[model samples]
Structures are given as structure tokens and as C-alpha cells.
Target: MSMAQWVETYGQGTVLAAGGVLIGLSFGFWAQRSRFCLRAAVIEFWHRRFGEKLSVWLLAFASAVIGVQLMVLMGWLDTGSARQISAKGSISGALIGGMLFGVGMVMTRGCASRLLVLSANGNLRALLSGLIFAVTAQAALGGALSPLRTHISSWWTVEGGAPRDLLAIAGVDHWAGLAMGGLWLAAALFFALRSPQRSVWMWLGGMGTGLSVAAAWGFSQWVAAESFDPVQIQGLTFSGPSAEWLMRVMHWPAPPIGFDFGLMPGVFVGSLIGALVGRDWKLEGFSDGYSMRRYIGGAILMGFGSMLAGGCAVGAGVTGGAIFALTAWLSLVGMWVGAGLTDRWLDGGAADKPTSLPAEGFKRP
Candidate 1:
């Protein structure tokens, strides 16, 4: 059956769910296998080692940018329809939220994607972190904290008008924008090769992650175009979808689940598969109450910050920025600065030492 006909018969939600599952599952598998962690990427850059890990992340972002632009060139996607693409941005929100999310990521020992992967590996601590992360995100987004969040986000919004990208700032056209995005991706590959010791597996994993994000855009666009009920054009993102999945679970008459909704569970399942294949599956937990306290605090901050900044590290920094949104870049800088400060604090004023990622970041035996 045709995509449009299939949507009519099985429901657009179903098609989207299926697409989300495939995308999320593949991404989760590669992420685990590659040990792709953005926090570690930043730390590597900070210490000036510029290792393979950071290169993987940059390559992923570049791949995503190239992929999305390819679809755009083909007229298969209109990236402007995505929520992350906007004429205005919350400058204060991006800075504050990015910093808070960064600190929270350090405390919880993982970003949104890493949390999903860890939970799949049977890390009970990650399970708790995921729960707190989801519930708090829901609260900040549409629950009790909505009023405060709305107030803060609206307090100092900046309106750039039309396009809302770096290309616009430079007064460039669509073709120039595409060229620039391509250059960014090429630059990422060049840097990846510069790393003294990057495994082929790491390179593949990073590229795979980018492909997932790019594929998500194509899938979303295809469905929206084919279906009578148009869906939002988007790529991979966890912060908002994490909350959406939670609400769907708690509600009796759940609202229609979007394509992105299926991604989290797919990631979980994919991570499980990766662990089983890699022989790294293991069950673990926190050492003490202090750690629990730290996790809760971190989750709360991450929830608030992600909502305010409009995304998490992967959501805002990689996926969104690759699509050419201006806020993504700002949020990324904020995350870098924030994570750096937290790393310094954890290092006990030994600011010169390289920051260490949490144990959860590793695929332990």
C-alpha cells in the first residue's frame, strides 16, 4: 500500500510509531556500541587531548546536518516546520537552561540518550534517574511549574524574524546555507581523522547516530506529506518526548502518541540488544544516600533546564543546531561552560585535571 493509503488504514500515529521505533532502536544500539557520550566529548576538548570520543560527536552532528540538507534539497522536508526552528529564542533561557542541564548531566552521570542506554543495560540508578527525569520534565513542561517556566522563558525572548538561522544573520540564501552546513560536516570528518587513536567502530557509531537523526526528519516529512492529518516535521529529540511518553503511560484515555514517542522505548530495546551482543549487560546501583540525593537534584535541574532551553544536549546541541537553528548553538556554548564549572567543582579546585565521566558512561563487564 502507498504511504498515504497506509496512513489512512493504520493511522498516522501507527506509521509514525513504527518509524520512531526503527530510528530509536538503531540509534540506541550504535550509541551503546560506540560509547558515544557528549559530556565526555566536551571534557576531552577541554583537556586539549581532542580524542576520538569528541570526534565521534562532531562527526555525528555533521552527518546529521548533511543528511537533513540532502532531504531539504530534494524538497522532501521543510525543516522550518519543526518546533525547534523559530524566529525568536529565549536567550536567557538558553544560557541558564543549558548550564543547568549540563550540571544535571554531570550529576546524573549521563545525558538523555546515555540515560536511556544505561537503563537498558539494567542500571537501576539510571532507572531512577529516568523516572525522576521524565516526571520532572513533565512538571516543568505542563504541570505545576508551567507558570514559573512560562514567566521565565517569556521574560527576555529575542525576536530575529524569518529563517532564524546563522545563514540569515549573514544574509545568505538557501543554497549558501546548504553549502555551509556541508562544510560544517566536512570539517567534522577532518577533525575526526586528526585524533591519534579512533577505532573504526567509534567512527561508524557516530555516523550511524547522525543517520538516525537525519532519517527521522525524512520519516517525519514523508508521513506529514502523505497523511491527511499532517504531523510535525522533526528529527530525534528526547527531552520533550520523555515527558510525552510518561503522560501517555499515566493517562487513561491517552492522547495520540507521536513518532518521537516510540523512540525512547526503541532506544531501550536497542540498548538491551547492544549489551547482549557486546557481552556488557550488568545490573548496578548507587553507593549511598548522598548519591541518591545528587541524582534527584540533578534530575530536577535537568528537567527545568531542558524545558527552558527547549532541549537537552543532544536535542538542542546536536540535532537542533545541525538543522541550522540559532538557539542550538547558544545552548551548546552554555552547556560547555556549565559542564566545565561543574567538572572543576567535582575535581575539588584541581581545575587543570581532565574531567572524568561517570561510571555509567562506560559499558562495564
Candidate 2:
């Protein structure tokens, strides 16, 4: 029987939840092993040392682009039906929100994914930051800050009925996302492999993580299309999913859990397993009130920014960009610029602060 047919037989929730757990496990493992962080990747791309980290990201994105596109061609996913396809993601939101997210990641010394992994390793700071980020993101999505985000984005939003992705924006055929995906894959691979520092596991980590993203997309698509129950077609995103997961766990079915509910904790669980395997688990906490305050502020910024930008670093920068969304690319550029600025700002003010976390994943390499 086909995968969709099998999902139907097994039940959509069961299959989707299982698939989510599997992807989350693999993603958390790879993320921990390679110390993946998009902000760090951007910094290292310009600053060196962890150029390998940036290369890892490229490999992951490249692999994901090709894998997802192939699935599209094979009819596993109707690219157009995915949530981001027709939505003209707001240009203002992508720029401003991305900048805010970049700054927040820099201040907290990790993005959402990095913080999640760190939390698994017994970093209390990360745990707190995760909670703060979740709550603040929830607020932006549906609480206090929602109106502001909605208003600004509406003022600057692109109209519907245009080409769905950046490929079309750049004068390429939007429907030829697969072909364009190949070109992008080639570019990312070329740069990544060209790096002098090469490790087998790092490559495996990158490739594996990317394949997880691809598999998530395909699997989500299949279930959403084939299942009797309602499902949202999505892939690996951190911020919103993090909030959704937190609510379900805290509220316990007031609002039913969705695909992301399985994904969020699964990531933490998988990361914890990875830490155990690597013997990297450690007890870590804030250095002082000053440090704790910084984390809280940063988390709030990231939460709000992610909602405005339409996703977090992994959501917009990797997953959305993998499909060549214009908004994702725009958010990425804003992130690069924002991260650079934050680095400069932080460097001037606090050079002697005590480190509470291993910041190599988020720091200026």
C-alpha cells in the first residue's frame, strides 16, 4: 500500500505524530552534534573560525531544497498547497521582524533551536529563555502584540494573485521550483564542500537534518491531503510550534494539540538523548541578575519578531527559504544585517561579562 494509504489505515494522528517524533529526534541529534545556529552561521560566514558551521547550514539547506523538490516532482507534495505558497508574506514584517529576531538571538547567545538543545543539556538559562520565548511569541501571535504586527504588515503586505515564490519574483518559473531548487542545491553544496575543514559526521549531521526537513514536509503534506481529520501542511519551525506545544502541555487539551505538539517536546527529548550519547550534558544557569534580565529581554524580542516575520530562523530562513520563498530570503538578509549590528553593539558595551552558556554556537566566531 502507498504511504498515504498506510497513514489512512493507521490513523492520521498516529502516523503524523510518529513521523513528527522521528524527524524531531533526528533533527535534535544533528543540531546538537554540529552545534548548528543560523545567527552563528551568518556571523561565521563573515568572521571565519566556525566557517564549518555555516557550511553545515548550507549543506542542510541544499540537501533539503533538492529533497523537497524531488518530492514535489514525484507528487508527494503539491508545492502550491503548502501554507506559504500563495501568501504574500509582508515585506515590512520580514525586514523588521527578522532584524529583531537577529538581535534577540545574539543577545541571548542562541536561536530557538539552539536554546532548545541547550535546555535539554540542563541549561536552566535556556529553559527559561525557551519559556519566555514561547509566551512572548504566543502574545504576538494572538495576544497583545498581534494588532501591531497585523497593522504594520497589512500596510506593507504584498497583494495576492502574484507568483508565490522568489523564483517567480526573480523571473524564473514558480512552478519550476524543483529545477530552481537544483540550482540552489548546487550552489550551496559548491560553497560548503569548498571549505577546507571537512568532517564526516558533520556532513552526515547536516545531510541528515536536511533530510529530516524534507521528510517532514512530504509527510505533513501527505497526511494533510490524505487524512480524514484536519491537518496543517508544515515543516520544521521553532517559535510558533514551541508556543503551541507549551500551551497543550500546560493546558492539557483545552486547545487540542496539533502537528507541532508532537514536534516540540520530541526535539527536546531527542536532544537530550544526543547530549547523553556525546556526554555533553551539563548543569548551567544564569551568572547573575544582569544575565537573567538579558535573557528575558532577548526572548521577548525573538517571540515578537518571529511572529511578525512569519517564522523564526529555522522556519523562515531554512524551511521557508528551502522552497525559495521571497519572504524567507528577505528575512535571512535582515537577519544577517541585524546579527552583525548586534555583535557590534554588544562588543562595545560588555566585553567582560561572565559566560553562562557555550556561546560558540551563537557568538561571533
**Residue lDDT tens for model 2, 196-311:** 76677567887887888887898798778777777778888998888786677677544654567678778889889888987889898887898888889989989999989889
Runs in model 2 lying further than 4 Å from the true structure: 1-10, 48-50, 174-197, 348-365
Per-residue error for 272 in candidate 1, Å, reads 1.2
Q: What do the candidate models score in CA lDDT, each in turn? A: 0.80, 0.77
User: Residue-wise lDDT of candidate 1 within 135-246, one digit each (tens)?
Assistant: 9889999899888788887877776555456657777666766676677667667777887766876788888988888899899889999988657787788888899888
Task: List clashing residue pairs in candidate 2.
Answer: none
Q: lDDT of candidate 2 vs native? A: 0.77
Which clashing pairs does model 1 show? none
